[model samples]
Target: MNLQRFEQLIAAYGSQAHHWPVAERQAALSWLQQQPDNALYCQAQQLDMLLNQSVAPLPAPQLYANILAKICPTPFRDGYFYLCHWLWGESQWQHCWRPALLLGLPLLLGLFASGLSTPSVEDLLWLDLEQSWVLMMAGHEMDL
Candidate 1:
């Protein structure tokens, strides 16, 4: 590989030859051997050494509790469960409405928004065609 590509590979995968893509590994090794005093390669090796020495900090117990609470919240704290209980009073058949409303509301809103948008599909197609025609004319003018 060229010097620039070899430098990019070193930067991306560190100076370790084994970490590089299998296809490019031999080429990279050859390039590195040819230019043994590459500054980028040395810098990458130093950076990798520093990164390997670093340890990740442990997360707090409270963070786990907060994430779990959000994922599987109590009926009293969860808006969907609370709303279902308030309106339908824990009937098994009525609980079906919960999933329907959850999925339908956003879909209905999207349909309403699309209906209210100014540009129709036909209008957008015509606009695209017009832009293409203008570009073609500009290219023709440039040729002259």
Candidate 2:
């Protein structure tokens, strides 16, 4: 893979490098092994050290309360801010409708516009399949 994509994969694995897919982990490891003096090798070493450091554990009860507070705020049962955050946090749903519209709108507009512009094959009977093919094949006909 390209260096940029390799770097992205490393970043995604983050502090949980061990959690990276086995095949990808091996590939990264192999690439690094092959290039001990590579600039990326130094970066990878720093990243590995960063991943090895331990994070301070939070109290389960406090963590749960914090998560709930963020998801379901205190102002109301259905708080505007909470709902907005929820929608924004999971933006895949927003993109679902967007892609449909992006694809469907162009298709629909093309169909509508075609109706207003061109006649169907049946309507243009003078230019039958045989006649059209002959004209195309004839090129610039003989001078005679």
Candidate 3:
């Protein structure tokens, strides 16, 4: 890997071989062994033990409680689940895409079609001026 990527991997994964990607772990270990004096690697390894010892995040207790509901069997969510999400809020990421596609695609298509059908905004304004001029001529002819 390049110096930047190596430094990134060192910073993100630490000096531990197991923490590194499985495919690259051996290569990184070898590189570290070959270059123990490398200043970049030394800096990255500073928190290697401390950060690893720190607790990794655990999922919410509510998620595990959902498995219990599977045995109890709750009714499936309906379309109103999304419609009411703005007020109650939603946690799951999978809910965002469907609504975006449903609403955004139609809006995008309408704008695209409007642009395609236009004589253009400038042409519409000029047409309005032409109609006004015709009305003024009609008024002048009526007076004559």
lDDT against the true structure, each candidate: 0.88, 0.68, 0.75
Cα deviation of 27 in candidate 3 (Å)? 2.1
The reply for model 3, stretches above 4 Å from the true place, is 1-5, 56-144
Model 3: which ten-residue window has the lowest total lDDT?
74-83
Report lDDT (Cα) of residue 19, candidate 2.
Answer: 66
Tens-digit per-residue lDDT, 31-77, candidate 3: 77777787877776677757767887999999888888766554455
- In angstroms, give how far residue 106 of model 1 lies from its true place: 43
Q: Is candidate 1 or candidate 2 better by lDDT?
A: 1
Where in model 1 is the C-alpha error above 4 Å?
A: 75-144
Q: Give the winner by TM-score.
A: 1
Order of all candidates by TM-score, from best down to worst?
Answer: 1, 3, 2
Per-residue CA lDDT of candidate 1, range 63-116, in tens?
999998989878677887667576564677656776677778999999999989
Per-prediction TM-score: 0.42, 0.29, 0.36
Q: Look at candidate 2 and tell me the lDDT of residue 12.
A: 64
Model 2: per-residue lDDT, tens digit, 1-144?
556756676566642446667777777666656655656546666877875787997688888888988886578756877665554555787657666665689899999999898877786886687798787678656433
